[model samples]
Target chain A: MAAEVEVVKNKQVLLKDYVTGFPKESDVIISTENTISLKVPENSSGVLVKNLYLSCDPFMRGLMRKPAPNSRTPLPAYKPASPIYGFVVAKVVDSSHPKFKKDDLVWGLAGWEEYSLITETDLLFKIEHTDVPLSYYTGILGLAGITAYGGFYEVCNPKKGEKVFVSAASGAVGQLVGQFAKLTGCYVVGSAGSKEKVDLLKNKFGFDGAFNYKEEHDLDAALKRHFPQGIDIYFENVGGKMLDAVLLNMNMFGRIAVCGMISQYNLDEPEGVKNLMWLIHKRINMRGYSAAEYYPHYTKFLDLVLPHIREKKITYVEDIAEGLESVPAALAGLFSGRNVGKQVIVVARE
Target chain B: MAAEVEVVKNKQVLLKDYVTGFPKESDVIISTENTISLKVPENSSGVLVKNLYLSCDPFMRGLMRKPAPNSRTPLPAYKPASPIYGFVVAKVVDSSHPKFKKDDLVWGLAGWEEYSLITETDLLFKIEHTDVPLSYYTGILGLAGITAYGGFYEVCNPKKGEKVFVSAASGAVGQLVGQFAKLTGCYVVGSAGSKEKVDLLKNKFGFDGAFNYKEEHDLDAALKRHFPQGIDIYFENVGGKMLDAVLLNMNMFGRIAVCGMISQYNLDEPEGVKNLMWLIHKRINMRGYSAAEYYPHYTKFLDLVLPHIREKKITYVEDIAEGLESVPAALAGLFSGRNVGKQVIVVARE
Candidate 1:
């Protein structure tokens, strides 16, 4: 038998227990007790990855809750005391896998830890272009970019001069959807939680109109004020009252691309959408989709967005926390609209 | 003016006033005061017809309510103390229009009376296939047929062996949608108000399962009992709480084609659907459309269903009243689920 390889301490963010109502930062625990053998085992074809950047995505909230009895979700809950996982930009520290070599850069699903032993095939994509900031692999050049591109062009089917409204406009996916709508010659409006984010949407993101929902007493009146002509396309992020208001103001034959429902994720009972009758009167299509469905179109998505990004015609903003221990707070803040842009964290550096 | 134009009494159903809640028979008046000339004006390109049968549709309730202060409907409210209009089967008494002449048979939007002078050029469809019962023109062969064909085939986008659920499953449109799904080799379930309608759906229309929703206190459990694998297509007719329940049982990538919400039309505040979060979880598409959108495809639709009707491969049922004076009760009964099948009333024999 070969001599045992050197082991190193691995810091991780672990789930404390199953969540109810809103998840608290205390639901996750940062631990430094775990250790890992940094070298790949001779019999395994897996790669040992050092997580460089980990994302705080809204969908991650689902993993903290106990799923409803008799219903099945696409993914399962994170085991108690186990490391939570999400989209990550990583460096392959060691590998026995045919597709990856030591020090190769990649982006895909990984654990919220200092390192991960990834054995699943097709779970990771080799980072192809390295000219841009590597952290972008956590968002714009990855999941967020593909989502906004596919959702706007394929699902909502926007046309020139259409009125597009995006909720959570400063979030990872919302910002890109607004920019994509603009590139398609649309009139865009966005809503966020704070005045600063609202200002970022209008002045920095080039939105035609922006409003802080927290300051507005009536969401319907605010939507009416921003969308005098009614919304032609609604990119849904925050659900509940915002969705109900958007439904009331959708134009004839409108489309709503439902990407996420950050507002409703933490609630014991999500608020009801009351104005769906407008769905019939206006002839709308409200579609819900997973970003994975568009993963196959990554090259096509890059072809459309990469050029505009290179010319500085399209821009992205990210709000990142530092270190692996920061994951819990950064993730919990998403439900409360605490982040200014795409929420991500730098876990480590090469 | 050359001769005193011959005129006759045209007994009609007239709206008493804009309705506030559940419409009553008292909300309409049977009037003998209306008179019509026996001929079309010489200068006009229009037809004067004696109405034979008029359809009692759920959508007619919209015409009863004065629209919201901030909104507009495609059609306006029925004028107080004036004749109401609907889909009608008629005999042309006189015509200056090139498409019709004396003794021509037709079906179109016409006044609920003994006679209608129709000036809208494209409103009428000349009855070309006379082999079937003429009353079929009021239900299966007219707007209901077109609505079912287009909504099921175009909107739901079903494939063989998929599961389908239709609400208000014994009504004019729902019956046809069920039969269409059966003919397409899909497993279908339906919900109706009465046991008689439920029996008709399963034994007559060949639906795989049928349930009286009024008897089921837990719609979600009822749906699960019928569709353990979850619903693939939901043809929404009765909205409100039923819609909320259906949302719970819909399969991933399921499609909901919204037709009418008879249960909601009379409600001052329609029930809010709370399970919309399932839309994101299941990746569903809920689309709402109008029957008018399918009118241009009448010929294509006829080509598909006409042969089935000839071969007795498809069947339709009607709950018809005997005279024009019965129109108010028959139409009002639709909202209460009082009619067993398609509701139609005879206005004249010839």
Candidate 2:
């Protein structure tokens, strides 16, 4: 096995080139010739990690676009000829940093390769609780988890008995938000892209109601039917026309937490929401936030959510593909809604 | 003098046959005979008051629209044949209710006529802190003042050294927000419709910078020039294209308090904001609120602002029309940006 590993070297999938429109599998390529040493560099201030699981998220589509004139987070965050990177659960194979030791399980930004060398020490967090599956760190325990927690609690400021609606209910962050809202004593409903996801939301996540957005001819009517009292808090994972429809149906003083606009990200023109005037009329509070800002609550979150996972009070699902070669398809699957729950690529076995 | 008094019975105006587009002076007609005695019915639990002053706001333009399916406010709030009622400073001539009494000055919703009978006791607040001019209650001492205070301080959560850009600088609410932002140690800038208002913002209201929005060909560039560091708090009094421009110039985690959308109120088709996607990129917070909702804060606001008004620390501007006959033109002026500061109709002198 070591001989075969030595012959093949470390494989990586490059950006190939910056993307346009909907990103195709051809936009990124798997190249096997990239090399990495098993040992950490002498006098280095970096951690050498063996990437085990890589996360696929909708935000990567924005990264694929070359920095436009008005772009804030630039293309340099994902340069061409460099390996693609995202949230990944990894093992510290060797560490030159004093804080981490060999075999320490960590999760953060890592490359789409068998191995990665990271210089940004602050971004890396050492994993502590492992009662849940380690692959969950790539999702429910990592960025996606924090996103659901912060966007729902912090941004929406949910009150008990408030009606909450989540778009993309079967997706990684949306599923967790529905559960969190339920725990908060709020009535929660969710909209998904498929029948399977709709069922999962109601049966597995215990969402108050679930609807397939594709099957619903009128989103406004669908929301009204599901939420007769009107929605107080909207966890906005899907934007575009759904946002417009939701705006029309929102109750007075509604709070909209826009974690991401997945529905609009890959579109050619990105749909325009005509009903924004409703925001003014209804006195809605709409805010967009990133999860990275809520790191202070991570410990408290672990304390609350870990127990739920242990007692089977909460559940998480993942669509995982094996090998670094499957990374491209795993990410592409996110856009098409082909993968239910969180999609993760397993680069190596323990 | 008794015959003149009988001939000069206080009048009210009706919008002429539901006009569309920008309001004109010809849209309203006045009749002195329309008003009844300034008294609540016998044994009734309503408070009847003499409307000493009537408020003319940009929002009234929306009320003038023929009732639509999606109307936010109640229909009787703006009856066509009856006198239009809004925020007014009045003197309780007689009361059948426990909360108010004869000669008590109050700030509340009132008809455009010389008197109004209000059964809704919750809406009226007995005017306190009379050390300031009673007319001040019609402007900086009343609804506009509290709207600015709550929206800027509570909704925006403004920080010291934050950059605050207020649209419609010299208008009723905008003028107060600039002062409040300054009081909070924020650097304030404002956009007005005319050069005089621009000068008034900087010289009178103490805004750090002010611009005539009408003169600026490109509003985004105007915002950039004034707020070189990007705006942290945007007091949005004018929506449509101005809002789109402001979105592009917002800093990360910026807050926009939507007080009113004066620009789009009269249009058949409200303009769409194209750059809304920036809300996600910039992590902006946009919230809309009305002064009525912040009734709990009225005493707190009065206690803070009254002293400032009495001491001349906070100066208010009023465009007063001497008689009810001038009320139509005064109200119409709000939409065209003709009224600088608060537009008020003074029906009588003390």
Q: Evaluate fnat for each of the predicted models and list the values in order.
A: 0.73, 0.49
Query: For every model shown, what is its TM-score relative to the native structure?
Result: 0.97, 0.93
Off by over 4 Å in 2: A1-8, A69-71, A74-76, A268-270, B1-10, B16-20, B32-35, B70-77, B128-131
Q: How well is each residue in B1-350 modelled by candidate 1, as lDDT tens digits?
A: 39788899989889999997898988998999988899897787799999998899888998998767867777767889999998999999999998898999999898888988999958799998988888999999999999898889999999999999999999999999999999999999999999899999989999899999989999989999999998999999988899999998999899999998888889888777788888888999999998888999999888888899999999999998999879778977988889999998987777
Model 2 chain B: weakest 10-residue lDDT segment is: B1-10
Tell me the DockQ of each model, to 2 decimals.
0.80, 0.51
Which numbered prediction scores highest in DockQ against the true structure?
1
Q: Name the TM-score of candidate 1.
A: 0.97
Model 1, runs deviating above 4 Å: A1-4, B42-44
Compared with the true structure, what per-residue lDDT tens digits does model 2 show for residues A1-350? Answer: 33322222788888888877777777788988788877776677899899888889888888877776755662245668878877789999888999899999999887778888887877688999877799999888988998998999899999999999999988999999999999899999999999899999999999999999999889988998988878899999988878888988889999999888887778767665666767777899999788877877999878878999999888998988998788777777788899989998888756
